[model samples]
Target: MTRRAKRTRPATPQDEHAIPLQQQVNVPVLNLEWIKSRLNPATLERLMQVWGLVGRLTFPPSSSGKAREGSRRIPTADAHLLRKAGIIEEASSTITGGWIIPFSVVEEKTNGLRRRWIAWPRDKNRDDPYKANAPLLHISHYLPPAMAEAASCLDLKASFFRVSLPRETRHLFRCRVEDGTLVELTRHPVGYKAGPEILQIIITSAIAGVTTVVHRLWAAPPSVRIDVWIGNIRIAGSKSDATLWEAQVLRNADSCHATIGRTANRAPRSTPSWGCSLVTHTGRYP
Candidate 1:
C-alpha cells in the first residue's frame, strides 16, 4: 500500500504572524446619505438636472475610458458605499462598468417641479433611436389662468409629464391641433447639449404606456376646449432635427383631423405653402 502523506496541521498564529509584511486592510462601506448631505443645494440641483437629462446613474468617464478597477480605486469604493446606502446597485456584467439605480430612488421635488433620475448608455455605438438627451420636464406654453383652471378640472391622471415645443418651431411646423400631436404632448426638453434628440426618446417612452394620451388636448372637447395653441414659428427654423420630427408628428395629427386649427401667429398664415414644405425639406413626408 502507498504511504499516505501526513496531514498538514492548520497554521499556528506564530506561523501566520511570521508571514512577511502583514497589514490590516480597512474597507469602509460607502454612506450615500453622507455624500448627498454634503452636497450644496446648487450642486444637488445640477446633479438632478444631469440625472434627469441622462436618465441614469453614472460617473464621468475616467482617462482609461472605463471606471478604474482594483482595490485602490476610489470611485469603486464610493460606489460600494453608495450601494451600502441603498442608492444604487452593481449591475450585471451585461451592462458592464457601472452601477444602476432606479429612477425613483433619487427623485426630488423643488419649486413644485418633480425631478426624475435617468441613466445614459455607456456605448456610443448603441442606437437609441428615441432621443434620450431631451429635457424630461418642461413647463407647458404659458397657459391662460382660465385654461390652467380648466386643466385642473379635467379628470386627468393625478399628474403626467407634458411636452411643448418652443414658440418658433411651433409655427414652422404648422402644428395643427390634431395630427402626431401625441409626439408633441409627450415630448419634453432634454436639459443637455443633446436635449433635442433626447426629446424623441422621452416621447417614445411615454408612448409605451398605451393608456396615456399624446394629444395637446389633455381631455376631449366636451370636457374642455383646448385653450392652448401649438405653432410652427421658431419651431420650423430651429436646426434641431428633433424639432423637425416633432413638427411632422404634429402635422400628421392635424391631417387626421377634419378641421385643423390654424395658428394665431402670422408666420404660418403668411406662408400657407410652408405647411407642406417640411416634407420637401425634411425628406420625410408630403
Candidate 2:
C-alpha cells in the first residue's frame, strides 16, 4: 500500500532586520498618559509651546547637529522607568562602538510654519523590520498650476500612528535620551526610516472612504479635486464648493480622530501673467 504523504505547515517569512534584546526580552509598552500626568507645571508649559497637536516636538538642530535642548526636562524618576520600558537609551561609549546619529532640521514652507527633525539612520536601519514605501501623492499635470480659485489645505495633528504598531515593529524606535537612558518608543516616533511610510499607510487607510467620496461626488464639470500629500489635505474647487468640501473633510477628520490645523487658505495664488483657462480638476488641458 502506498503511504500517504504528511502535510507540513509552510515556513513563515523571516524578517531581515532583527532587534537586539537586552536582559529584558519582553519590552513594556510606554504609558504616555501616566508620563504626561507626572509632568511638572514648567515642563508642561514648555511642552505646550514646543509640541504641536502631534505629540512630537520639533527642535532646531544646533551647530553640533543635535536637537536643541528644550526648556522642559523629563522627571528623573520617570526617566529611569522610561529607560527600562525601552523609551530612551543610554549614550554609552561601548554600545554600537559609541556611534550616534546626528539630526538635521528642515522647515516645510506650507501656508503655515512647520519644521521636521531628521535623523541619519544610514541606508538600512537595523531596528526597522518593515520596508519603507511612502505613498504616492496625487500628481496630475492637469491640476491647477496655482491656487487661482478657492482651495483649503489642512494639516493633520498628531497624525503619526493612529493605529497601534505590530508588536515586532515596536522594538525599532530605540534611542538614548540626554540622561543616557536607553528607551524604545511605544508610539511611532519621528526621525525613523519607516516613520513617514507607516504614517502614510495609516492616514491613507483612514481617509480612503473620504477619498472615494470626493472622487465620486465631484464630477469633471464641477472641477473639484482632492489631493492628499503626507499630512496635508488640499481641496481645490470654487469658493463655496471648497468651503463645503472643507466641512466634509473636517467631518472625515473627526471620524478618524485626526486634528486639522486652523490655517486654511489659497496662499500660493497664481500670477496674472499665467494663461487663464477654465480650470478643471484635470486642469485646462484635460
Candidate 3:
C-alpha cells in the first residue's frame, strides 16, 4: 500500500472564551415571573451553599419588596447524587444579578444540567465594555522543544466560586430570594466582566516558581513556564519538574480550599516525545 503525505491545516482559533456580539441578543433578562417559572429550588439552594464556602453568598437586609432588574435564573436539575456528595442541599433562598445588565444561562457540554451565568454586552445601561483577553500561555510560547517532551494540565474544580468578589462590587450582583430576602454574591460569579481575569491572576500567582526535575539533576532549576487561561493551567518542563509543579499546584489548591478535578494525570503515559515538530503554522498538533 502506498502512503499519502499529510495534509495542511488552518490556524487554530484562540477565542475559546469569547462571545460574539450578535449572540448577546437573546439572553433573557430576569424577572419575577421568569425566575419562578424556571428556577429549581433545589439547584439554587445547592449553588448557594457551594458558593458560600468560598464566601460567594451573603445575607443582607430584605429588599423591602424592592424589585431588582436584569436578574434571572437558568434551568438546572436537582440530583440525589449531588446532594449525597454533600455539594447540594434541600433548602435556602439565594439570588444574584446586577444593575440593568442582561443575564443569560449558558449550557456547557460538560456541565450536565447546570446552567452558567453570563452577563450580555448588548444589555442597556452597561457601565463597562467587555473584552476577552487572550490566553496567557500560547502553545508555541510555553512548549518549546525541550518542554514539550513532557507536560501537565490541571483543572480546578468550581474555580469561579473560589474567587471572592470585591466588597464594593458585591451590591451590583444583588438579587432577592424566594421570601423576598435580599442577598448578594460575595464571591465572583461566572458571568461578570472581571471573573476570568481575576481567576487567572490568582492561579498564576499561586504556582509561579521553577524547581528542578527529579529525572534530571542540575545545578539550577530548569526553565519552566506556566500559562493559565481561566481555570485550566498548563505546566511544561522536564519530567521531574512537571511532577514537582503538579504537587505544588495541589498544595496551593488546598491552601485556597479549591477542589481540583483529576482529569489529566501528571502527564499522559502515551504522550509522544515528538517535540511538537508535527505542529505547523496551521496549528496542527501531534
Candidate 4:
C-alpha cells in the first residue's frame, strides 16, 4: 500500500479577539415587511457590516512596511469568498494613488443582484476605462407633471441620469430611461474618495436642462402643494458649486403656480377629499 500523505491545515487563531464577536451573535432578527417598508437605510447598513467582516478575515493586513498600509486596507477574506460565491467580484486594488479597490470589480460581483439593489445610472461599457472609479446612482423620488409626462412619453417605470469616471479622469454620461424621464438621482461610490462627487456633477448637468424644460411647461400655482427631495446624490464639497446652479434652476421651476384658489390669502384644500395613493401619479402635480 502506498504511504498516505500527511494532511495539513492553515493556522487559525481561536482566541476571542481573533474571532469577531459578531460571529458569536445570532443572525440578526429582522421583520420582512418592516425591512421591505424601510429597506434603503437598514439594508445598506447591514450589507456593509457583512462586507467589512468578510474583508477583515480574507485580507488581513500585511506585516511588511510598504505592504502594511496596503494590508490594513485590504478587503476581508469573506469578500473573496463572496466573489467565489458570485455575490461580489474578486477585490482588486487600483494603481491610482488611493489604495481604494475598483468599483468595477465590486459591480461584477454584485451584477447578479444589480436590479435588486438600486444602482447609479450610467452607460454599460465592457471596454470603458474608468469602470472601476464609477459610482452607483440610486434614484429616490420622481417629480410630478414632468415625471408623469416623461413616463408617458418614454414608456418607462422611472428614469435617471448617471455618470461614471475612469482613471484618466474622463467622464461618461448616460441617460437611464425606464418608464419615464429621470426625476431623481442617487450615487454609491466604490473605490476613490472623490469619485462620487465627480460623477454627481456629470449626472446633474445632463438632467438639469431637461428638468428645467419640464418645470417650465408644467408651471403650477403656489397654492398647489409641492414636495421635493434633494435626491440621493450629495450636493456638497467641490461639486456643490455646480450642483447649486442646477438646484437654482429646479427651484425656479418649482415656484410656478397651478390653478388653485383665486385669492393669494386663501389656503387651497383638496376638493376630492381623498388621500392620494403613493403608488400612482395620476393627479395634478403638487
* TM-score of each candidate structure, all chains considered together: 0.22, 0.43, 0.47, 0.23
CA lDDT, every model vs. true structure: 0.26, 0.37, 0.37, 0.23
Per-residue accuracy of model 1 over 173-255 as CA lDDT, tens digit each: 11111111111111122223444332222222121111122333321223222221122111222234424343443443333
Q: Rank the candidates by lDDT, best first.
A: 2, 3, 1, 4
| Error at 30, model 3, angstroms | 29
- TM for candidate 3 is 0.47
Q: Which parts of model 2 have CA positions greater than 4 angstroms off?
A: 1-149, 161-168, 208-223, 263-286
- Most lDDT-accurate candidate: 2
Give lDDT: candidate 1, residue 93. Answer: 27
- Candidate 3's C-alpha runs over 4 A off are 1-68, 71-125, 129-147, 166-169, 178-181, 208-221, 263-286
Q: Is 2 or 4 the stronger prediction by TM-score? A: 2
Position 283, candidate 3: lDDT: 29
| TM-score winner | 3
User: Compared to the true structure, candidate 2 yields what TM-score?
Assistant: 0.43
lDDT of 4 by residue, 1-286 (tens): 1111133222122321242211111112112232122223433354334323211211223444221111111124323322232222322232111122221111111112111112222222211223222234333343334332111111101111112122221111112122222111111222222333232222221222232212343222222223222212112112333334324433422222111121212211111011111222344355
Give per-residue lDDT, candidate 1, residue 107. Answer: 15
Q: Please identify which of the two predictions, 2 or 3, would achieve the higher lDDT against the true structure.
A: 2
* Model 2: ten consecutive residues of lowest lDDT: 267-276
Minimum summed lDDT over a 10-residue window in model 3 is located at 271-280
Clashes of each: 37, 15, 5, 28
